[model samples]
Target: MGLRMASGKLRQSFRIYEWLDSHKISVTSIAESIAITPSMVSHTIRGRKNNRRVLKKLVDLGCPQEFLSLPIDLEKQVAA
Candidate 1:
């Protein structure tokens, strides 16, 4: 079974992902800016991982605070 995520958080995650996409932000760039691995940033973006530092950096880069928080189930979203 896939991990479960709240509908609200799922939507928020998507919003954050979309915002990043529209702004041409890449996981590699985020990782470089925050001194973390690109995989960590990518996982965080996909809601498969949670890293406070990464989330903070994303907020610093203009992502809305409300749309960023905790981790969700990317697999479930994809399956749907």
Candidate 2:
């Protein structure tokens, strides 16, 4: 294992995906901007990817700070 997140589960809903969608920015476009794959971006939104580098990139791309305060609720979101 390279780096394991302290919390195996992500602990917040990073709204980056929503922002990108609302702004009509394609995942590929943002991925290119951040030098990460589109799927990595998708996984971040879904709370499946929790690498520090990716999290930092999301923040740089305008992910709100408030999202960091929201508790992780992947199962709840999935159920809804």
Q: At residue 71, what lDDT does model 1 achieve?
A: 36
**Candidate 2 — what's its lDDT?**
0.56
In model 1, the Cα lDDT at residue 23 comes to: 95
| Candidate 1 regions with alpha-carbon error over 4 angstroms | 1-11, 70-80
Query: Quick one: how many clashes does candidate 2 have?
Result: 0
Global lDDT of each candidate:
0.69, 0.56
TM-score of decoy 1: 0.65
Q: After aligning candidate 2 to the native by TM-score, how far in Å is the CA of 66 from where it should be?
A: 2.3
Q: For each candidate, how many residue pairs have backbone atoms clashing (under 3 Å)?
A: 0, 0
Residue-level lDDT of model 1, residues 1-80, one tens digit each, is 54345323443667887899999998889999989999988777766677667876786788875676533453233235
